[model samples]
Target: MNKQQLQQQIEQVYLDILIELNLEKVDTYFAPDYVQVTDHITTDINEFKAHLEKLKAVVKSLTIETFKDMLIDEEKQTVFLRYDVIVEKKDNSIGNIEVYAVFTFNDDGKVIACNELTKEYDEQVKGLGSI
Candidate 1:
């Protein structure tokens, strides 16, 4: 697929898996041997799914606030994206976070590897404090 197509696919996957918390759709975007590296841990596809499950348990809702930037390197088959997110917890607390992620896709356009960094802001009172 072309760079534009790949970028759209990546965005769809993020919305489906991250924002929607649809673990069942993971295989549509991630390869069987997917690997994820983050500040706290590195995990394979199964482990990543488990991690998402844990997150879902604590988070009541997640929404992407903005797509700050996106860069695609066709030659490297990699895409980098920066975005902001708002997370609502089960206890009704809200948190805003900024994320930078890099995804490497296989020839089939399935994501085989990913690395990300996230900075979470302090909790905010409803309709009050800045993110």
Candidate 2:
């Protein structure tokens, strides 16, 4: 697949992260040996799924607003995406912010890794003494 196709596959998985609790969808999108490297965390495919499961239990839905930035390196199979996310919770609360995201897909069009740099609204509130 080309760079666009690879980004599409990665974006789909991110979109599905909130809508579906089915791990198999992730399994289908991500290579079995996928390795994720985040700003503060690094994990394999299974470990990342575990983190998603925990998130799914608390986050009711995720709304993403993505901007198609430059394809940083087509040859390297990577894309730079900028997005805003609304992380919905059960208590009628929302976590909203924009962040930078990167996704890399394997040769066969499965996402090999995904990473995001996001800011937490609650954490910001805490800094302002509103936690």
Candidate 3:
């Protein structure tokens, strides 16, 4: 896929899967062999889907506040995105997080792998601060 197409697919994953909590979109956007790596966990497609299901059950609402600096490399079939997300839980507690994610797509334009780094914001501090 071209850069523009890749960008649209990536955005759909965030909008349709994450923010919208539409688990049905998982099969549409991700390859069967999809894998994801993060600092605390590595998950294959099934495991990832289970995790999302759990989140969907517990989360009252989710919003993507910003999706910034999306860069797509057509040659590598990769896209990078920086984003901020706000999530409210069933108990009404809110959490904010910033993330940087790298997504790799297969030739068929389905996401095959992803790696992400995230920083959870402190409700008191507003920004990262020294202890």
Candidate 4:
């Protein structure tokens, strides 16, 4: 994919899957063999799905606060993204997290792997980045 298309794909994944918690969109944007490593914890597609499910259960709302940076490496089929997120839990507590992630896509433009790091900007939520 071209740079623009790849950038759009990355943004759409954040909008559709992460912020919206739309589990169905996982199939549309992610490869079946997808894997992710977040904060040194690795998870396969099934585990990823479980994490999302758990997130859905606890989170009342999630917002993308800002896209700090985005870079596309066309030759490597990878995109690097740094963003901040605000999350509100069911109990009405809020937390902020800053995430730096690298996404690698397949030729078909579906995400196949990701390596991510997250920092908790506030103490309201512990381990919020992982789930």
Q: What is the C-alpha RMSD of each candidate to the true structure, in Å?
A: 4.7, 4.4, 4.6, 0.9
Best by TM-score: 4
Worst 10 residues of 4 by lDDT: 122-131
Model 3 spans with C-alpha error above 4 angstroms = 123-131
Scored by lDDT, model 1 comes in at 0.82
lDDT of 4 at 56: 93
lDDT of 3: 0.81
Model 1 alpha-carbon miss at residue 40, Å: 5.2
Q: Give Cα-based local distance difference scores for all models.
A: 0.82, 0.65, 0.81, 0.91
Model 3 TM: 0.89
Per-residue CA lDDT of model 3 for 2-83, tens digit only, reads: 9889988888888899889899889999999999986557889998888788888777887886787788999999999888
A best-first ranking of the candidates according to their lDDT comes to: 4, 1, 3, 2
Candidate 1 regions off by >4 Å? 123-131
The digit string of per-residue lDDT tens for model 2 on 1-131 reads 67667666656776665456566688777888888765556788778777777766666766766564645567888877776666676666776756576777778777777676665566421211101
Worst 10 residues of 2 by lDDT: 122-131
Candidate 1 on 5-106: residue-level lDDT in tens?
Answer: 878988899889988989999999999999998764688999888878877787888888668899999899999999877888888988887778899999
TM-score-best of 2 and 4: 4
The alpha-carbon deviation from the true structure for residue 42 of candidate 2, after best TM-score superposition, in angstroms, is: 1.1
RMSD of 2: 4.4
* Residue pairs whose backbone atoms clash in candidate 4: none
